[model samples]
Target: MPAHDPQATPADELSQARRLLNRVFGYDDFRHHQGEIISTLLAGGDALVLMPTGGGKSLCYQLPALLREGVGVVVSPLIALMQDQVDALRQLGLRAAFLNSTLDAETVHATEQALLRGELDLLYVAPERLLGERMLSLLERARIALFAIDEAHCVSQWGHDFRREYQQLSVLHQRFPAVPRIALTATADQRTRQEIIDQLQLQEAAVFVNSFDRPNIRYTISDAPNPRERLWRFLEQEHPRDAGIVYCLSRKKVESVAEWLTARGREALPYHAGLSDGLRRHHQQRFLREEGLIVVATIAFGMGIDKPDVRFVAHLNLPKSLEAYYQETGRAGRDGLPADAWLAYGLQDVITLRQMTQDTDATEDFKRSAHQKLEAMLGLCELTSCRRQALLAYFGETLEAPCGNCDNCLQPPQTWDATEAARKALSCVYRSGQRFGVNYVIELLTGKDDERIRRNGHHRLSTFGIGRELNAVEWRVLFRQLLAQGYLDTDLEGHGTLRLTARARLLLRGEIELHLRRLRRPERGARERRGRTVLALGEAEQALFEALRSRRRALAEAQGVPPYIIFHDSTLAEMAQRRPTSLGEMAGIPGIGETKLNRFGKAFIEVIREHPG
Candidate 1:
């Protein structure tokens, strides 16, 4: 552990932090608000930090834990995340340990003893564990640096991923008022942010608001006529053999997707709340340690996962809210590299979500707020402008200029005059008695005469067969846009029936011009084009990169750790290109700090020296 000098100048503290940043985390500088957040906490002040997942949220707390005298108590929420973090910190030669439900009795006792002995620099525990009498008693005896509340959004009941244990975290301030506290999360909108400040009792904390934009993740939303096929197409085109997550809305769907991908020769696993604890841990561990393993899961899966090189995040169904969507997508491109965020949605997504929200047992106000978030997500999917701009705006940040990395920016969709189409669709809903769902109404318009349609004697209606110009898929897009744009609403009491609102009158009477993006289903066997690739190197350097990766895989397998824990792919790519021949030069490269230089530096240098490329 590095010693902190009480007589040290402020310059010395800053220099020490930079030295640790390079020596431990393998970075030369702090990213975004990390430096300021760390300094504020180290100065015995409280802080609320809103950084993106890949934006170095952990470093802000971890660096301070090293700079200050005592162990930084990080109140994490998940077991897998705690293990991933502790493993990474240990690899960096830091004294890090964790206490959670997964640990056995002996191990827990040993870890507690270490905390009291002041042998550990950083200690991670779940909120429930931290609030326990035993753990609190142990912490009380130790000289504490600060309390880092990771995933602080879990404290907000309004968030999609709220946890009851997180609300109890305020007791840390009540018990240890002199110790500084830092609450951190990667996902929180304006309201949820305020809710976190309130719930965590951090009213005096300085707020560090990092822009929520993940510039490396390219966003794409497709109409799902056949989501299974669409997902395959996305994989074959955008991310073949890449490590990613395929998000589903249900546990059953998660299982099926995992099975389907595994059968197709892809490394895949399923994770959800319905699975056994052992199975969940196994799948989660495999995802962290194994490269190119896809974890098909519901929202139950991610929130504190520290795997840095996840190449993509695909959504087979719409998430519950925009906040959820943002957090999930932010999981990709965490290595400061290019990645993809893909989704396939149709009319069913909107209806199913609306129905699910209506059926929820939460308060009416909570349901309404959740519905608004869903609407915001729908707007992002149907948006014609910059997706990044709208995504940031939801979190109370604005983009002065458009980002050119999203699908809309790359291949802009064509807008069509849907005024006549909107009138026909609205009239069909009215003439069909405004009681049927989207599919039933769409059938009458597209002229698919089902038994129910014929039984209701709706074939003779004037609105029937008027929507021949648009297919069922296209019509679904229109209706979904209408619902999203306030022209229609779902009657929750009537079992997901579609109803026209007063706003629908404008489109019905030609008072407003309706224009919608004409969605195009990709041609069969057509590949989706990707944006710029990450860590681009020459062909000769590519060979060296592969060799470095092969060696990294072997080292990781032997150590029972993730490959990125040794060194991220970005660092390897830099080594491949620069081809440093000596230890002195290797030490100067980014990500190769003194600890790593002493440990694996010689072996990597040997690889580079022998490679003929």
Candidate 2:
């Protein structure tokens, strides 16, 4: 793998890549469209790759960076992300370094010397650093292999993680027109894809649209009355002693949740913009380097997280859009084990999001576009079919059937006529002059004679007290589904006032059928009652797995790195199940690259021998 060479055929380059994969990365074959994507890059062609999170996107660029002639200049987004990537590369015996503000000038100069001397295979530079005049000059002096623009969705204004600096990355294409460039992102819809291409100037790049389905992740959404207790249920029932992320919408939520969990004896940390830089860094570092730790964070966390064994991603509120939800939950189950993407959303989440979108300082067109995006996410919560199928469908990919993993597909939601109920609710709104929000209609239907209802004489309406057959909680569910199903609309100008849309008139006229799902009661005792005691392996083998995990943790602690960095839980599970005795057998294990085998093989093998199952 040098700076320049004669043309290599596809078969030749692939053979070379397979050899490198086994020798360096420890995997035997490429996952999904990885082989084709890497081959395209090695042949000096550009690509726009849309692979799901944990779909081995890193290898698409990392392997090519090694096979190409010059050092691969990767324009990454964050220092933490670069550090984690470089750490993984170094563990694989690859020469990888990232230049960011964290490095002292002397260290930066030394890394520059390494690059100029042709001693590095992959160089990770933040986009800001790469666009600087001095860094551009440094690249001019060194042999270039190709460029990889990671987290490419950051370049899209409509993307959840939009960065002003990333918008300027088109300079890479302009400056290095001949070199092949690959832009990679975990989550991007059709519009975002086009935005990425136009923003990055990769018009001619071969597009690779891998399926967005993460089948191993169990998707669950509950409109729970007590979201905190519901989240506790998920954490206790599903993921104990596993690394996971809990995403909140605001900094205050992050802090309170973190504190609440901490008081309850969970190793939880708060991460948001409100925290000092040092405090945020410390919390992030702890979350990475430790296990069984949950980080209650705003959207500020999880961009650069490379931890592979995050077993669950829990959300206390609804995400802004489907793409944001997809990206956030993707941080879980990266090791390809069974993971859960659990959410607790309600009508308030919808109302809050709608109001937020309408109150944005952007123009009406921008606000309208934002509202549409928010609606897509709300639709997911209202889905009665398969969560995964609906999610994939949003990205223009169709799942042939309901994924057995999501909650809806497993225990299909029960739908009732709800036509009479929907009409009653709509009549309540219409008879009340349709000037109130969802809460008011729900209150009137539930026969709650509050002061406002009594003062406004709203309780005397024909629709009022007509819905007493349903409780307040149940009525709220019907109203939410009505709004989501387009029988009702929110007046953003009226501050979330509920109004009838055209579809509601049909229902009122008895010319339309309406059905709504009954809200499922949240589990109150899963976490405390069953804390993940079951194992994929048998009793004897399960003991060996624990021992192996203990040993990995010891080594990771000694090295001051995340335990997954040493050996992912999936890999350890395989090792425990297989009961490899010798180094040769260990080498055959998945995730055992040559460098890791050389460094940690004998120790793990010895442990297996000492605790033979």
TM-scores, each model vs. reference: 0.97, 0.96
Predicted structure 2, TM vs. truth: 0.96
User: Could you tell me which 10 consecutive residues in candidate 1 have the lowest summed lDDT?
Assistant: 525-534
> Which 10 successive residues of model 2 have the least lDDT summed?
525-534
Candidate 2 off by > 4 Å: 1-7, 523-535
Cα lDDT tens digits for candidate 2, 253-327:
999998998887788999999989888888888888787889999999998588887888999988998989999
Candidate 2 collision pairs: 2-69, 3-69, 26-593, 236-527, 237-527
lDDT of 1 at 66: 88
Report how far residue 196 has shifted in candidate 1, in Å. Answer: 1.3
Q: Per-residue CA lDDT of candidate 1, range 1-613, in tens?
A: 5787888776678788988888776678887988888888778899999998888888888888888889999988887778878887888788999999989999999998999899999999988888899888888999999889988999889898889988888889899999999999888888988988888899999999998888888898887478898888788777777889999998999999999999998878999999999999899998988888899999989888888889899999998888899889888989888898998887778878877778878899989988888888889988988888888888889899889998888878889998888889899999999889888899999988678888899998998888888887788888888887878888878477999999999888888998888776576665544422456777788778888988888888998888888888888988998898888888877787777778888888888987877
Error of 1 at 396 (Å): 1.5
Listing every candidate in turn, what is its Cα RMSD in Å to the true structure after a full C-alpha superposition? 1.8, 2.0
Model 1 TM-score is 0.97
